[model samples]
Target: MNTNEYPTHRLVKSEDLNHHGTLYAGRSAEWFVESGFVAASSILNPKNIICLKIHGMQFRTPVKPGECICYTSKTVYAGKSSLAVYVKVARVSNLESIIVDGFITFVHVDEHTKACPHGIVIKPETEEEKLFYKRASELGR
Candidate 1:
């Protein structure tokens, strides 16, 4: 496990695949963003946070029916009013084979939907953490 990262599972079915018989990019993206939203909401009020940027979602494998995908998400960086979450999706059968990965940036907002500081800080302890935090910070610019 990576810090407070959590696993979210989704079963592959007919509706999730594209015409070419592989998982649809659109569907994968939906889950990616949803996982990031869940990560942010776990720390802040769900109503107080909204997605700002996706950074990027890189698809690395093709998934077919009968395969279960696991999405692992964690808040990697907290800056002022923005929080960045890193997510990795892979099949449950092969944990080492990553199907997709990305970083998503979210902003904390007030009741009026304006950006507000969350006053939280995350100290990157290991090299991996530092790398993710660095990449997340780049999305701000």
Candidate 2:
């Protein structure tokens, strides 16, 4: 795969927190999907893309207020009309610790919002990419 990463950063504010004083799941999900969309759209027209599914989201840790969370997304797999994007969320100060990670699938559509082929193809070039490509294919099945 290209392994091109699209990164987005967000500051955890009071409004982004939950009752337990940590980042809310809803907010995180929104950003995660957005990041995935960016990755998918990078290879296709943004106006022709729509999110089809969120395969899974794993939250390994909680994010607190004042922390700058970075969301990095990359396209790991692509089918005729769909792309699987993997997103990783971590603190900018400590990229080693992943706060969350997930895969989202997006489809290319025509002007009528019907599924259409996206002519993009990705070839895995590394062991990590190969693993993610395999996982993405399994998710499609």
Candidate 3:
């Protein structure tokens, strides 16, 4: 997938810093997974998807309260009913990048059986998608 094809969302009340201050890691994680789901669903079957797991996530900088946190996500690869999504969280103001990023993986399963089918349905539709596929491949996913 190309970089532009990645899905992105701005800050909302649900995504906020914890009582201890700074961004809540759990909220950030939830946003990341949700972003992943959005990206994957856009490419494949939206109704049948579920977040299977978060592979690796590292916070380089803390997102503070009232800051506009931006989450960008894209599908890196598709296998049958499953797709690996990579998400990046950053603080943006006047369009400046404040943080780097991380990733999450989601799977598409049968609504009833919850079993993953076997075949990539969403092929790269644009240059951005192709680029994401390349990047995901480089990461060994």
Which candidate number would show the highest lDDT if scored against the true structure?
A: 2
lDDT of each: 0.89, 0.92, 0.67
Q: Per-candidate TM vs. native? A: 0.94, 0.96, 0.73
lDDT of 3: 0.67
lDDT (Cα, tens digit) per residue for candidate 2, span 1-141: 475999999999999999999999999999999999988888888999999998779789889999999999999999999899999999999988889998999999999999988888899999999999999999977
Candidate 1 residue pairs in clash (backbone atoms < 3 Å): none
Runs off by more than 4 Å, candidate 1: 1-3
lDDT of 2 at 23: 94
Error at 75, model 2, angstroms: 0.4
Candidate 2 Cα errors over 4 Å, as ranges? 1-3
| Each candidate's clash count | 0, 2, 8
Q: Looking at model 2, report the run of 10 residues with the lowest lDDT sum.
A: 1-10
